[model samples]
Target: MKRFFAKKVITALLFTLILFTFSFLNWKVAYPDLKVSALSYWTDNEQNKWEQLSTLIANVSNTMSDKVFEKYTYIETYGYIQELLGKNEINNFEVIKATDGTLHYTYFTSGANDVSKLVERMKRLNQAASEVGSKVIYVMTPDKYITGVTKFERGMPYNYANETADNFLEELADEEIDTIDFRDLMKEDDQYKPESFYKTDHHWKIETAFWAFTKFVDVLEEKYGFEFPNEELYANLDNYNQITYKDSYIGSMGRKEGKLYSKVEDFTFIYPKFDTNFYFYAQSGSQEIKTEGRFEKSVTFTSLLSGDGDVYDATNDKYFTYMDGNPAFAEVNNFNEPNGAKVLFIKDSLMVPVASFFSLGCSKVYMIDPRYYYGNIEKVISDYKFDYIFVSYTPQNLTEEFFPFYESNLPGRWWMHDCPFINWNGVL
Candidate 1:
């Protein structure tokens, strides 16, 4: 009875300490946010007050959790404990470590998604492209999990994202829409391995993305009769200065898993050795920013490579060092190669580097991440009349979040051309 009482007392003390620490760390951050959220809801003129309140509450909850003091410390401690326990899964297997020591995000999925709607949406997009004398090609970026490779211990969850991707591409093929599955190409390559991908993130490594870009260039040349000047030199890795930042990157999945469980990655920042000039523009809901210089100065976010702070810092996402994370709309104009080709990419974050490298061979490169873009894509297509349009998404991103404008049947909006942000003149 005495031992039981002692144990209860200890547990109570520990719980009290945690509560006190959290309150001390988060109250300042949460109180103001909550107050602003409440005030916004009060002033909001929207019809759905209840829904707004719910969303505000959810946002507040996330803020509280996120602002918790020493959150990474707690995560690291938990991850360390998980490691001590010899466990392969964490948080009830929301994240599973592969047998090869790579981390994967997964959820329970029974079967492949019915992608007929998505395929139809692509068809509509293709039709729009065809009307402007532009070609649409769906580039399927590979998932981290290679079918026979990327093994998990028995009884781990499988999300069937790969199966959905297979179904999605097959449907597109049946519709006679052109497609490129990087999975097939990667599998055929003798050099592609589990390590070709980030051990902790869904994204492929920079080198892999570069390789994909070269392959894409080949496709454009052989099939579309698209020519890139100085192809041999531009395609060669030796032509670029490859700077590898040792153990500086902690990917998205790694951020969730913590440094203790998912170790940091070595990030390679590659830039061209030859002279080049570019005008880069990015616009999102919150900000509009532009840069002009050579490839490194313009496209690459050099601050990320400064290596001044914690490598495990969540904000120090090295993958985003290229193209500075995905914006709603971004463009790159290569002044030297202005007469080459104009290309547009409807893509997810994976295509950031792909498009960046592609800019070298193109006069202009325009990119849109549909998740954040609220504009009329049909309008953009009609206006630009791009030489080629590539829709690139990782296999796992075969979801509606990546297809925001598909449901709307409205014609190209006249307002889109009038928007100050849209570049009517090819001059930056």
Candidate 2:
């Protein structure tokens, strides 16, 4: 009995020591930030003493939490423990793992969001574009959670993003705004299935985006009388070199859930085997960067795949390999097909891969992510005068964050400049 009592005391002492070590490490990491925040309380005249104290406490608390030693390892270990317990919910249920071991972002919501304001803003944007003889088409990308296809265990939470998308699309159609609902294709089209999406990520797979690119071309040709030379050649999968990097990618949600909870997925890299050249340009503020060369050398960030470290690390995000991740504004000038359509895409991150694929058969493809862009969007539409404009967004992004045209600053036309590939004069 004495021996057992001694063992219990030793175990308790060791656990206390381990807790102290972790706490000390976290405090050390947060010390500098805490010092700065505390000092700012004296210097800052913007708020009252109580408010400043509140802010300082909040900052210190956040730093201590975020700067915890081996934070990700702790998270991964926690996820593994959760898996062992057959837990469906993780991270206070901010992320849920389906029975199939897929990580998904979800929240508790009672019903669909009010999308009427979003529709009105889109209508205004459409009217602005139409005034300049440019047609606007709202392209609804599929959400990761397909209504009937993805199933959660009993008593699991659901965020109503799909239902919200349904109402949003119906409202857009009622306004006489043109739309292509990819959800309908996901349900009816035999070619596309739940497999089209990434199990661990919110976005669809790169291969799925390539397939959607072909559909976009068909829409342009059949509905709008647009034509691209060598359309079939570009659309053919055989024309591209397909390389699959097995068990490489851990997507946005997967990063949160960790490797033990979410299975790593295969990332397939597809690019044209044909001789292709593109002048890629991206701009933010007064700064501009351009890459001009073959498709592999220019658009795709090959360094992402070749970089050192575990591919599952949140830093080595493979989904961002296309278009070098999202920027405020970017455009691709396709030299191979000079006579192709000049198109503009106002989109979210999901369309990055899709736009990259669409650029294959286009003379120029201008893309804007409103979430990051601060420019005058209406002015840009009037200035560029693209043949057709596509406003693409995933269902989860139907909020005002993606529709910021009215609030966008009229920062004057600063992008008009001399470039070797760009037609600043707007001549096709």
**For this target, which candidate reaches the highest lDDT against the unseen true structure?**
1
lDDT of 1 by residue, 1-428 (tens): 99999999999999999888868768875676667656655654244566446656776787787666666788899988888887898778888998989988888778877887789888888888899999999999888888877799999988888899999998999999999888888877743578788898888899998998898888778877888987988899889999999888888778775888888879898889988899888876435768899999998888888987666664467777778878878889899886888989999988899889989988999898887564667778888899899998987788887875445456654333222347533354
For model 2, the stretches where C-alpha displacement exceeds 4 angstroms are 1-69, 284-288, 310-313, 407-428
Query: What TM-score would candidate 2 get against the native?
Result: 0.80
Note the residue pairs that clash in candidate 1: none
* Candidate 2 Cα lDDT to native: 0.79
Query: For each candidate, how many residue pairs have backbone atoms clashing (under 3 Å)?
Result: 0, 0
Provide the lowest-lDDT 10-residue window in model 2. 412-421
lDDT of prediction 1: 0.81
Candidate 1, which ten residues in sequence have the lowest lDDT sum?
A: 412-421
- Top of the candidates by TM-score: 1
Candidate 1 C-alpha error for residue 169, in Å: 0.9
